[model samples]
Target: MRPRADAVLSEWFGPSDGRLLAVPMSLRGKVVGVLLALEGGPGLNVAMVQQLTYTVGLMLETLASRPNVPTPALTPPEVISGEPEVAVEAPPAVPEEAPRAVEEVSVAAVEAPPAVGDGSETVQLKMPIAPAPPAAVGRAPEDERKHEEARRFARLLVSEIRLYNEQAVQTGKLTRNIYSHLKEDIDRSREMYEQRVSAEVRADSNYFHDEMVRILADGDADALGV
Candidate 1:
């Protein structure tokens, strides 16, 4: 056998008796390496060449997809260039003071003499001190009832204001610039409500505030057609 330039990879592998097959190992249509197969029993055919080419291509593609290759992260590399970190120390605990001695309480029991003659020992009973009544007990029930009703009304007023404001905002008539003016109007409305309705409906300061918010919201909604 002689080395021939006309043959496939002749000079690289030297002269051989059997037929040689050179298949390209590729990934994504790019050639990565070459697969060399020497046919021992039979001559190389089209079916054998196709099978070998497909198997080698799949292996190369799998290897390329694996995490074996080292890749740079897309994010900016972190810099260790900064001031040296200082270790934080916890605060020292305070020493506890010595406990004071407790004074002993004395309880006296007295026995009373039997009044005529059956002769049974009678014991004198001592009554315990009663606790003082709560602060609410000092307030009249009628006033408390009125205050509760006022609080409930105030909460209702708040709900109404929220609904009206939502509608006003949707209509685009309410702007941030006139918020202070609206607030002033609300305050005026609350003062008027308090002066006129104080006798009819007993309420707290919060009740007047809620009423003011409601009045402003209603006025804005009416102007906006919302």
Candidate 2:
């Protein structure tokens, strides 16, 4: 039976078929059903077969233990199958015509200008001048040093991540001839971590440089006093 199943799985390599090679379904650590696929190429390898068998077994065990409950038959079953099930909650409502407090501003009154020397009538116009915007505060010297350190660390981290990714790819190619989900997960985690670190570096970079400058300024001031 196993040999015939294997042969059938191998036959799945035919161009006409586009199905899975083999799917072994199990229940309670035992083979309850064998899903022999007749699509796709070259059939299942020993490892794939083993993994599939295990996965099937786990699923069957769960189903077997689950209490039998009459599930509501979905109306238009095809629609349910075509689209994934997801619940979206409505966003909170905002109040209309929100209350607002009024702000009062004071304006200085200007006196009229005196008549000109020729006794001709003079008109004086006063325009309110706006205050200058505050300058952006500079970072401290210690902050500057920290920024530099962070930049250096970030570079090192990126280099290490690339190196590790390359190593993982090479290792997968040599040992398994295919990259596994575990390797993909590791790569994803590393990428996310790097992004987070980069954000932190950008946010604090200016302050880091400022701190270094402050330290240097203090040293110079002390030297001048001496």
Candidate 3:
């Protein structure tokens, strides 16, 4: 069949077989949408078309203007059935048993034993004892790290003091006046090392002092005196 132009879509997808028409669906004065019609035969009259458009537009406007209402917490679905609902009896609830009372024995009762009737035969009783908890072996991870850091700092500081004042250290060691010979270096290194290491480490431990004794005095702790 030869193509013919339809009034509604004449520009695009034009020359359609079926006659198309578009009428505005208006609410009050503003147009909401178009009510389209594709007619193959005699189309709807003006009155019917007007009624249909007005109904659709009114519904759209009402929905748009209406305030939102909160949905029910439990909105059960509508169950459609032709047959009537049959009454079903629920199962009886099971009765629960009452809890038993726990008996508490006093310290005196536990310590004191029941006297034997004859005292002729001796009976040995075994007591159930709970296993002891595991002992804590070593320092925690953080404490160990802190300790390691302190030791490193002490070692470095002591090494530096001995490094720069090698002559003084040697002379002091021989003369037994090590403290006097390397007093300045020793004091400065001690101060800096103590400052770097925390007071917690210093409270019980003398990592820096130990390092000075070990390194500066060549394992002769008394040589460095201070």
* Clashes, model 2: 19
Q: Write the per-residue lDDT of candidate 1 for residues 1-226, one digit (tens) a residue.
A: 1123235446665665555444444333344444555556566453344333443333333333333433433453344555785444544544444333222111112122332322222323221111222345556787665554554444333333333343343343454323343444444544554554466444333555433333333433344222
lDDT of 3 by residue, 64-181 (tens): 4334554434434455655686545545544454333322111110111232232212112111121222342586877766675665566556656655666788888888678898
lDDT: which is higher, 1 or 3?
Answer: 3
RMSD of each: 45.7, 35.6, 42.0
Compared with the true structure, the alpha-carbon lDDT of candidate 2 equals 0.35
Q: Tell how far residue 184 is off in model 2, in angstroms.
A: 4.4
TM-score of 3: 0.39
Give the C-alpha miss distance for residue 12 in model 3, angstroms: 87
Stretches > 4 Å off in candidate 2: 1-31, 38-43, 70-226
Local distance difference test values of all predictions, in order: 0.40, 0.35, 0.53
Worst 10-residue stretch by lDDT in candidate 1? 102-111
TM-score of 2: 0.22
Candidate number with greatest TM-score: 3
Task: Report the lDDT tens digits of candidate 2 across residue range 121-191.
Answer: 22221212222223435967655544544533333333233233444433543454322513454345446
